[model samples]
Target: MTIRTFIKTTGSVALGLFVATLVVRGEESAGKAIAVRHSSTDDTATIQVAGLEKPLVVLHITDSHVTVADELEAQYQQYSSRMDKSYGGEKEHWRTKKKALPAAHFLNLLTLAKDRNVDLIALTGDIVNNPSQSSVRFIGKALNDTGIRRLYISGNHDWHYEGMPGSDDALRKTWTQERLLSLYPGRNPLCYAVQIGGINFVAIDNSTYQVTGEQLVFYEKETARGLPTVLLLHIPIYTPANTSASASSCCGNPVWGWETDHGFAIERRERWPKSGNLKSTTDFVDRVGKTGNLIAVLAGHTHKARTEKLSDSAVQYIAQAACNGGSRLVTFAPLMRDKN
Candidate 1:
């Protein structure tokens, strides 16, 4: 059997056991429990814990690409093939092969979050293979099962090609911005703020690839509030100061230099300028730096975990690892110096 088939079979068996464990544990812990509900709120769900004052923990999970059984093996094969091709057709690949178990990896991530006692879970987007209604619903159900206050946004994959069968017009009508917003509000909320532990966490929909005029306006308002802030988005904004050739490097090699050297570009075309300019993102970062209270910018979509200190600013920009197997834990304290 192929790796794809093995993953699917193992995931199915594991899920069955997980459900059984939950049932037995629920029965044993509680005498008579009828319903199991999960938290889907985007706002901060705060709970006071011992020894930690205003402890805010955000679990960042990205790019799970969850799908049902029928599509799982095929989708895995497709992604695996693409990764191999991108790496110059070498079958003995590690990065792609090592991180193919989306379902099992997601379950492990959930278990880790529960173990850490995370206060909130923020999904940076690309939750499904495509914008199929069933896939979206499946993602929602999986997240709800985690029982953590969750926030979801759209990555480019969520609506790039419109996987649902329909005409262009019908696809437009069916997957309207409203419908997508209802499904994934964290991305479409257009710069909403959630306050946890006296710090304002701002969710910006940078999935469009570029910062829009409307988003700039929202950023201005949030900055004016002068509250300690944490910005969350699907894509990490470009920072030129920390470009090095390493796994942890933010802006070099596979990330910003994929095309010239390896025949691939990490970023999609629409979101980035062909001239290879970082002006838009830099402008936004400069504005954010002026805010003084901006703590850190958290993002995903590059699938590589990296952290870079912005030039002349205290704001740390971090990209979490892909949810397929990558993991990142972001901690925010209420009283950090406003160097950024």
Candidate 2:
């Protein structure tokens, strides 16, 4: 069974199974029950939960690199699951060990998001160390447990694994687009848009390491609608400071660089240079900026918690911390007037 054939045949079977499981579980509500709680913190300190006239709150979690079923415990236990292990070619070992943490972290993330009562949960990407059928299923189950509107985009690690002869096909069959729709109904899994509370949430696949033309088109269409939009993808748009050229390889591991064939390399850097892409980013900003309603650009892939001000524009670029060690909480409110 070649990879292509396996994709055709086995994919169907696996997708069917996934769909069935989803149907059975769809009616069940998961997550901690929201309790009526009050806080005495100063008004400014508390996150305003009263929905904006058109309030849109997004909880973003990224780069979980989760390994399902504790498969990587030995490696994680050996190295203590450090995020910086790649500096000396030791990343693989540590990565293997810490793989299970992502799944656990994902559970914790969901519980936290539920507590926040966010309008939506956005998983920016790197959900698994390498895409595995079981890992994806586990992710689906976890999201269902959270019971909030959710969206998932691809990350670099997601396409790393090549499916076995029949395994690839089996997994595909079990997780088809239609099936995902049934499971996550209304919120399209693969790259689509949904209007929640007058704001447009446009999810795109940035797992391929570069932005594609299709994504740009989607952006144009969504932005043209005059609705404030939130763009979700795995990799942050590479800037000069973080390009593969400027960053040294992780010892012999090519995965850490910006231009590597696999890892974070800027495979399409020429086409999407920092300035050119900045224009693209700006174009997006301008579209929404014109409305004075664009909230923030939410992303993941770096696995570190960060918020960069799009100075010339009103948009804030937010990156969520990895779910493994700690998760970052994002509070959204009208921009403070004093900052002006």
Candidate 3:
């Protein structure tokens, strides 16, 4: 089947999940206007907006989950077009689901962004299913072709495999730092900050649960400048379990997914550092609280859109997928202060 047809089918399945996340969580979209329409066509239009001191249009998208050019696919595609290994049939259910999503959705989303003429695009993570060289190359070129400034981070899948053991070397081969640098330019692509249209867009590789000291240092330096900062990353920071599971859930270690969070395989995979204890979650959140200019946080991983407040000044916007023809628009309105 053609890529577009497959994603439309997957999106039909994901629509119910997307609807479940759309409760009126007060001010989650930052009091900006949002419109979603369903139709039989491109499903896009330009939105005219005003009333912000410094206005920048951002297209926030993620989790294309495109299983493009995997080593297995390279080895097996000629023999069999189907992409799953069967995993003793446990993998049976998801094989089609994976195939139903591809890098084509990213290209389609780029079309929407281009139509909207977005000033910037932030792909939160999981742009590819397994960080395959071919997938990354395709995504990078399409994104550049949009002629929009871009920012990104790697998700867990973008690095390590799901339930697969000790594949960091394999991951390194697929997601080479050079490839990482091409999309993200900095001494450390995993964490850095860039300025686009008078806002500080900070990206951190909280892809792992730990907040590395080096990342914290980068945070300090970037926030010191005191520009209105919008933090972007793969996973969310840990929040306490609320009555609603989704609200409480953030950060994917103890990894969140199809399987239960309790198991030897998953637990063994979630090892902590042997030496230095980086900042505590509270300490880091406290630092963010003090960073007066910090405004927003953007992320993806659950493959379900969500939002959770970080501090009085900051709210985290979690996206579901750009793969199933999904994208979110973020407007950084002029900084408004309480008139107390």
Candidate 4:
């Protein structure tokens, strides 16, 4: 999965919603950084939302890998499970910086969104560290709390593991269009579209690490409208703007910078067998570039905030995970015109 190269394993660490309503259009955002306060950690970002009567303020929150603390003890009692749960690397930040992955932190973010009057919230994915029913419920409840409309997508970890107490069949269930839509109100498909502030917001699921042929079709139809668009997804697409494609590589890991061959593309079938490609990864990026309408491609999986010039017209925004108490406040500035 070029898009979702993360999630080698559920325990491998890394991973992390909202709604919209009023089409409050104002002026193009000047791309200014507004300070947003949280009870525990204060975070801020400068955002440019393109092509709106007014700057459409969007909050990009990702990778809130949370599970109810109480549920864990219950599971232990039932299964007598002693699975090692110590996670390092990305999880370390939550312990040190954010205190812990408490649902309260997410509630704080929703409150901030309301206070700031964000138009729409793009939940790039991964609401749980592992796929537990309780974990999914926690995220679902959070989304319901936000009065504002939101677009939610799934990440690798969301449905990657089912390792709770009940010992019958605890296999990891992959997220499907059916299951996901059922969780959310109304009919939200695996790949769906929402219109906000004159921009087409597309929520896509590339959690399998591969974009399907059907997904390509779904996006193409949405972009055919030719309105300025923002693509929301789980994994961050590697572009020359952020990743060093020319960087040297050791085996598969980047020794110098990073490689683009697999990172940027949705490879075709027969190439990758484990999770072989369904359609050309280029199908999506190429369309965005050629059409020149997609202003931004926002994703999360890296658990760090970074931006890239995906093309002359569009910029890719990779937001940090909420487990680390992070969110990207994106203000859509007016899109640069061709003038040709």
Point to the candidate with the largest TM-score.
3
172 Cα displacement, candidate 4 (Å): 8.7
Superposed model 4: Cα runs more than 4 Å off: 1-51, 69-98, 162-179, 240-276, 334-340
**Tens-digit per-residue lDDT, 43-153, candidate 3:** 221211122345688888877766556563464343223222211121111213433335555676788788988888898887765544666677888888888988887
lDDT of 4 by residue, 1-340 (tens): 2312321211111111001111212542211221111111123333333334666788888877665535543653322121114221233344346464345566667887899989877788776654445556677777777778788887765654333322111222334332354444664546788888787888877765556677777887787676667798887664434444322111112221212245322211111233323344545544544445566678887776666555544556677667666787777654332232
Poorest lDDT segment (10 consecutive residues) of candidate 3: 13-22
TM-score per model over all chains = 0.61, 0.57, 0.67, 0.66
State the lDDT of candidate 1 residue by residue for 192-302, as single tens digits: 777776656777766544455566667767745655556777766555554544332222112442233231233212222244424454456556544444545666666
lDDT of 1 at 143: 69
Alpha-carbon runs more than 4 Å astray in model 1: 1-53, 69-100, 162-179, 183-187, 244-282, 311-314, 317-320, 334-340
After superposition on all CA atoms, how large is the RMSD of candidate 4? Answer: 12.5
User: After aligning candidate 3 to the native by TM-score, how far in Å is the CA of 124 from where it should be?
Assistant: 1.1
The C-alpha RMSD in Å for every predicted model, in order, reads 16.8, 17.4, 11.6, 12.5
Task: Highest lDDT: give the candidate number.
Answer: 3
Whole-model lDDT, model 4: 0.54
Which TM-score value belongs to model 4? 0.66
- Model 1: lowest-lDDT 10 consecutive positions: 12-21
Whole-model lDDT values for every prediction: 0.49, 0.45, 0.55, 0.54
